[model samples]
Target chain A: MTTTTIHIPTLETERLILRAHTLADFDAIAGFYASDRSKFVGGPMSAELAWRNMSQEAGHWVLQGFGRWILEEKATGKTVGMVGLWYPAGFPERELGYDLYEGATGKGYATEAATAARAYAYDVLGWTTVISLIAKDNAASIAVATRMGAKADGTFPHERFGETIIMRHPSPEGLS
Target chain B: MSTLTVQQMLNSERLIMRAPQASDLQAYQAYCASPRSSFVGGPFDTAKAFEKFTAMAGHWIVRGFGRYVMLKDGIAIGHVGPLCMDESVAPEFTWTLWDGAYEGQGYATEAASTVWQHLTNDCQWKEMVIRIVPDNTKSCRIAERLGAILTDEAAPVWYPDSVTYRLYAGAA
Candidate 1:
C-alpha cells in the first residue's frame, strides 16, 4: 500500500509567517545556534545540530499530519527561528516547542507563533491535549508558557535535559 | 489599537494564537465528553463547548481580549486567556484542561501563566482575580499557587451552587 504524504502548509500570523522548512534556511539556522548568545535563547544547538533539527521538523510534517513551521520574517524573509509540534519516538504524545535566535528574543515572536500553532492544532487538527517540556531553570521559557495559558504540573527528570517542567493545556471544551 | 487579532492576543511558549476553525471541534468535543474531566461547572456537551469557543474568540473582538485556544504538538488541548468576570470585581484569571489524559501534566499552569503575564505586563491590567469553589481543591490549590488570597467573605449568591469560594488577587 502506498502511503499518502500529508501536506501541512505554511501558516501566517499577524507578524510572522509559519512555513515549511527549506535548505536555504540553513545559514540563518546555523547563525543562531552557532552563536554563544543563543545559549539562553533556546538550544545550545550547534550549526550541525540546527540543520538536523530543521530536517527533523520537515520529517515530522510528513509522518505526523502536523508539525512545527519555520518562522520567517514577513518583510525581510529571514528565518529567525522555528516553532511548532514535535512528536518523537517512544513519546507518541504531541508537544509544543520553539527555538529563536538571539536577535529574535523580546519581540514576542515565540508567543505569537506559538499561539497560532495552537489554534491550528485545537481548531484544525483536533488534538485533545498538548504538552510543553521546559528546563526548570529556564525562567524565560517558563514565563512564556505562563503567558500562553499553560500551567505547570510538576517536574520530570530527563536524561538529556535534566529536570524539566511538564506544562499541560487540556482542551477548550473543559475550560469554564 | 486594531482589535486584537487572534495573533495579537495569543501568548505561548512556542505557538501563535489564531481564530478557531471547525477542525478543533473533535478534540474539543472529546475533552468535554470525557467523564473523568473536571470542568469549571462540570462536563459540557458538544453544542455548549462550541458555543464557548465561539464566545471566547468573539471576546477578542468585542472586549479586545479574551480566552484563546491552546495549541501544542499540532493539536488543540485546551484554552487559556483573559476572561471578563462580572466587571464588578477584578478580572478573573481562568483556565481549563478538558482532556482527562492531560491532567496532572502541568500544562494548565504552563498555559495559564502566559495569559497572566499578558494581562499584568502587556495589557497592564491593574488586578486579576481567580475565584475557586471550595470543594474543587485542585482549583483552589492552583489559585494559591498564583498568589491568590482566601477571604472570609461569603460566597457570592450568584453562584448559589458554589458552597465556598476563595478570591485570588494580584498584588497591588
Candidate 2:
C-alpha cells in the first residue's frame, strides 16, 4: 500500500505547538464550526462542510506551500485554535488569519499563535508584508491584530464575507 | 507496504493516474465552473470550487488513500478512485472526467478500472462501493461495466439522491 505525504512544518511557541492538522483535529474543527464562535469565520456549517474545510486547510499546504497550523496548548496538549498564512482564491492579498475554538479565547492564545505565524511568513517564507483580514465587527480579532503591531490599512469587498477590514502587519524591515 | 510518490500512484495504457497536485487546480476549477458539472452537484462558484479542489488533494493525507487525477499527455483530464469522507462509512469508488470533449470515450472507465485494481490488488482493499445520482447514467454505466452490483443500501445522508453499487475485490 503506497501512501501520499504532505510536509507541513511544525513550530513551537512559548505555550503552544503550531503543527500540521491531523485527522483527529476534525472533531475540534467541526465543533468550532457548529458553534457561534465560528460566526465570523465562515462557520455555523454542517459537519459535512467542516470535513471539507479541514481537508482544504490541509491541501492548502500542499498547493500553496503554506497554510494554517493547529495551535495546541503545550500544557494540556489540547487544540486551542488554527492560525497561519492564508491566501485563498478570494483574498486580495496573502493574509495572516487565526481562529480560536470555543472556550479557547480570552487567554491570548490567538495573539500568541498569530505572532508566530506572521514571523514565519516574513522570516521563513520571505514575505515582505502580510495583512490580517477581519470581519467588520470582530473587535476581538482586531485587538489581536493591534497587539501584533498591525494597523488598519483599508477594507476589502469580500464576495461572501461582505466588507472586511484589512490590517497591515509591520513589514519585515519595519519590524527591525 | 510500499510507498509511491505523488506522480506514481497508478497508470493505464493511455493515462497516468496520480495523486492530485497543485498543478491540477486550474482544470478542476474550470470543470466546477462548467454546466457539465451538474451530475456531480457542481457548477460551484470560485470559492467553493477552490475549497473542493483543496479538499480533494488533502484527502490523500487524511485517509492515506484518495482519488487521483488522470493525466493524459501531461494534462489532467479527470480524477478517479477511492474516497472515504467519514471513518465509519465505506470508501467510495468515484470517477470524473473534467471536460465534455473527453466524454463518450472510455477514459473514465479505464481510469476507474486501473485505480480499482491498484487499490484492490496492491492495496488489498476487500470491498468498496460507488454512489451516483440517478440522473448520471453515464457514470452508472461505468459502474455496471466495472462489475459493481446495485445494492439496496442507502446512500450517505449528505448525498441523499445517490444510489449505491457495491464492488467486491474478486468480482472484477
Candidate 3:
C-alpha cells in the first residue's frame, strides 16, 4: 500500500462551509446513519460503517475529483451535514445529494450548501447539469429539491434504494 | 481528510492477513448477521453491514492501524487487529470471528500473534489493550492465550461492565 492525496477546495456559504471530511466527523455521521431517519439514504448503521462512508467521501475526492463535502456550520465549525456530487458504481448521473443531521434541519442549511455546491460544480468544475436521486417517499428532500429549483425528471426504480425520484438540476444561469 | 495507507500483507504460520476488499463485505456481514453476533453487535441489516464494513476499512485510514481481514487459502475467515474506536475507547487489540467451516481451527491465535507482532514491531504501538465484555469468555480465553494480562480498569464509557486486558509487545 500506498497513500494518495486528494485536492479539494474549501467552499463557503454565508452560514455554512463545504469542507473535506475528517476522522473527527465520524461521530456525527455515525449518529446520522444509526437513526431511522437514515432509511432514505441507506443508513441506521453501526459507527464502524459510518467511518467507511466518511472515508469514501475523502477517497472520492482523490478518485473522482469531486465528492460529497462535509457540511459545517461556520458559526461554530460543527458538522451539520454532507452535500455534493455522488456517482458511484452503477450510478446513472453525477448526483447532487445532501443529508443533514437531526437538529440542523428546518433552517435551510441543505439548500444553502447545495446551491453553493451546484454553482461550484458549474462554475469551477464546468459541469453542465447535476441530479439528486431522492427517495420517492422522502417528502422532506423533495421540498428541498423544489426550493433549490430542481424539477422531477421522473421516478427510477433503484435496486438497492427502492423507488427514487430523479430530480434534475435547472441550468445554473437560470437559478436567481 | 484521513487517507488510508495500504499496509503490507502479513503472514502467519497458517493464515494470511490482508486489507479487506469490497468482495469481503458479504462474509463480514454474515459473520455478524446472526443473533449470536450480539457480542460484536450483529444481526444487522445489509445496509448497516455495508456501513460497518466501510467503517472497518476506514478505521485503517483514521487510526493508522486496524486489523486485517484474516484469510485462509484466499478466503476471508476472520478479522484481527488494532482499532482506535473513540476518544474514550482508543487503541484496542481486537480478535473477532473466524467464519463458517473454519471456526475453532486455532486461526485466531495465529492471526492475533501475527498482528501483535506487526503492530509492536512495525507500527510502534508500545502496548496493546484488548477490551472484552465481562461475560465474553470466548474472547477472554483468546486474550489469555495472547499473553494479555487482565487489568483492573473501569469499563470504557462505550460499553458498561467491560474488562480490559493488557499486552506489552516490547517484552515479547
Candidate with best TM-score: 2
Cα TM-score per model = 0.47, 0.93, 0.64
**Top candidate by lDDT:** 2
Please give, for residues B1-172, the per-residue lDDT of candidate 2 as tens digits: 2233223477799988888888888999899999978887778978778888888888877656778999888899988978877677568889999998888989999999888777777767778879999899999999999899999888777688999999988885
- Proportion of native contacts found in each model? 0.00, 0.66, 0.12
- Model 3 ranges off by over 4 Å: A1-20, A24-67, A71-81, A85-95, A99-144, A147-149, A152-176, B1-8, B88-90, B134-136, B156-158
Better of 1 and 3 by TM-score: 3
Model 1 agreement with the true structure over A51-76: per-residue lDDT tens digits: 44554455455445577788998978
Note the clash tally of each candidate. 49, 0, 7
* Candidates 1 and 2 compared by lDDT, better number: 2
Q: Taking the tens digit of each residue's C-alpha lDDT, what string does model 3 give over B81-101?
A: 877655454367887774646
Model 1 chain B worst lDDT window (10 residues): B1-10
Query: For model 1, what is the alpha-carbon lDDT of residue B1?
Result: 18
Model 3, docking class: incorrect
- Give lDDT tens digits, candidate 2, residues A65-99: 89999999999889878999988888899999999
What is the descending TM-score order?
Answer: 2, 3, 1
Write candidate 1's Cα lDDT for B1-172 as tens digits.
1123323435467644433444565676677767634435547766455444444543443344556566666677777665553345665566666675666776777777666666555555656656566677766776666666676666555444343333333542
Worst 10 residues of 2 chain A by lDDT: A1-10
Query: Which is the better candidate, 2 or 3, if ranked by TM-score?
Result: 2
